[model samples]
Target chain A: MKDETDIQTPDEALEMAKKSRAAAADAGKKPLVYHLALPAIVGCLIASFALRDGLQLAVTAATMALLALVLWRVRKRGVWVGNLRGAVSYLLASLLIVLTLAAMFAIFWLKRTYGLDWPAAAIGAALFPVMVAMSLVWEKLRHRDLTGKMS
Target chain B: MTNPANGLEPLFNAPTRLQITAFLSGVAEAEFAVLRDMAGVSDSVLSKQLSALSDVGLVELRKSKLDGRQRTWAALTRKGRKSFAAHVAALQQLVQMAARAAE
Candidate 1:
């Protein structure tokens, strides 16, 4: 039998990557969706009300396409395919964008039903930046937590 | 590193080197000790593996002072990244062929 000190096959590299991906999760960049979600949501929401009926969806589609392009371009950065869990984490990250959109739509529904003004939209749109701020704050906290022990 | 386009990199066949490259491919950089821990190897073994990687220009190790203590970090170069991708593709191909053969 081959021992642990033996040379790893190419397949072994893949298997090892799949195995250690979770414990090493903190090493890679956060999923791309985390950075793009709020902007995409805010863009669609504003486009819906600010633009004319025909232009509303067109602008939203264009914005989404732009977002997709950007995401594709940056996809290779810090990409690590650890295992099924890592893959699922990325999948869930993208799915969170849909959830964010759903929340924005809920606000749109309120505006249409209750005759709320742009003030409501403004407040709703403001949440997107708030989310960004909170995530940034949390990221800093996590960074400090990670680095503090090391230094 | 061998030309990934040509074939799988035999260089990374060693378990320690494979583990190091695999982990570094995901992150921008990691402390040397972190990588050593990840590879589950001793100082000399990881140092030797890292030297091999560095010799082939697959990885770059840098030393700096952090909090008055010397710190070393390792990162995969662009060539390293391409090689890793190619090797992974080759591995996937082999797996598919094996599955098909078994079926």
Candidate 2:
């Protein structure tokens, strides 16, 4: 379509700007929405299992709360990390998934090798920190072009 | 009290275009994919609007390699930054006055 920026008068232009900006801002609000809910549910669920069946309910709740806070804090500051359309992003995502799976496997391995018999919840609790760390590192490395300090 | 809208650039007149400009205003520059998601437009739609924005010199679109990957990035020009600031101030004033009236 042709440029629609050539509307007749200032009033018309301003009105259009307001409407367009509102819509765009709404679309960009994705980070805030999922950052609020998903992190809490995922964090707590993972922590609950990682803590094994042995963690007190209060400790589990606290761990979940802590993980949720950490996840929210690590949210991409401006651009959406997931919107990246490069091979690098795909690599970062793959690395993150692999690391997470690896963390889970490590828990199983430790139980098998050392005869630890770690509970599922304890394993999940063990993986939480590693996952959170990987997420932050991956996001930073994922959009280094956007987030990296200007040279 | 100078006509705030007087400072409004005609280049940002289109709402979707305006939205794109607004998103670019906050950052140094952003990738096409990132901006497309922020603008909430289909790929072709955003490319068109971005070209329009570029034509008016309100935005700069650059294609380059980052971390061994090719990407298109957009940044608001100096003119765009000034124009958008004025527009936002005007909007804030309007909102404030409206709040007073409702109260």
Candidate 3:
């Protein structure tokens, strides 16, 4: 097996070493996805609580999954005590989306079963997917840069 | 055996040093704890390697204090960065040459 140590050159090796350090520091910053998605996540939790009987648990699971995904991303691509972190971010993110959908479903169930009005539920429902999709796209674009300092 | 491609080898060939360099390469500067974690090495081992790299003028170590605790940060000197860039280029060249030879 080819280990990183087997690679050659005094200078190139040094560059990789330095890049690893910068990568660590940059990884410390939370992804933009997390920041933007926070509001939608909060909305989901709120809606889930109001409609707990139907989809609350599922929504809650989705939120947990999303959080786990973000952390996974940090662990995988993000720097850990030097190269130990693997790439579990994608899986975690998927969990979050599922959680969000669950919450939306709960709201749907509530509107149908209860007398909840259309406008509020419609607005909340619309916001969740848009926010999640935007967050995903933003992270994909930002992470392409190795430094993780997009700006 | 040597790399037959460009007659050049990777610099900072050692594991510890490579970890250190990789960590430093991404940052403007880094403290001891930072590098320690990045390299996944003990204090003493990392310290020894840093000392050697510093001796070669490849790294610059500056000491300061954080909340009354002494702090040491490491950075690559200009010569060090240049050397690293050249080393990487050489390795790439070697890889390319080797590929061509195989073909």
Per-residue lDDT for A46 in model 2?
48
Cα lDDT tens digits, model 2, B1-103, are 6665565565565666776876675455667877677656788989998998788787888886654667787878887777787766665555555667789
Ranking by DockQ: 3, 1, 2
Choose 1 or 3, whichever is better by DockQ. 3
Residue-by-residue lDDT tens digits, candidate 3, B1-103: 5443343323467767766665565444667887777766788878888998898888899886555667787887776766655555555556566677789
Maximum-TM-score candidate: 1
Worst lDDT 10-window in candidate 3 chain B: B2-11
Q: Highest lDDT, which number?
A: 1
* Model 2 chain B: lowest-lDDT 10 consecutive positions: B4-13
lDDT of 2 by residue, A1-151 (tens): 3344445444454454554444333333444334444434454554454444556476667756767664444333333323442477577668757856775576567667876644545655555555555455544443443333211
Task: Please provide, for model 3 over A1-151, each residue's C-alpha lDDT reduced to its tens digit, 9 standing for 90 to 100.
Answer: 2243465453455355446745555554455666566656666655565444657688878977877665555444323322112144455456667766766676667677885745334556666676566455544443443454211
The CAPRI category of model 2 is incorrect
Candidate 1 has a TM-score of: 0.52
Local accuracy of candidate 1 as per-residue lDDT tens digits, B48-72: 8899999999999888665567777
Q: Which stretches of candidate 1 lie over 4 Å from their true place?
A: A1-10, A27-151, B1-5
Which of 1 and 2 is the better model by lDDT? 1
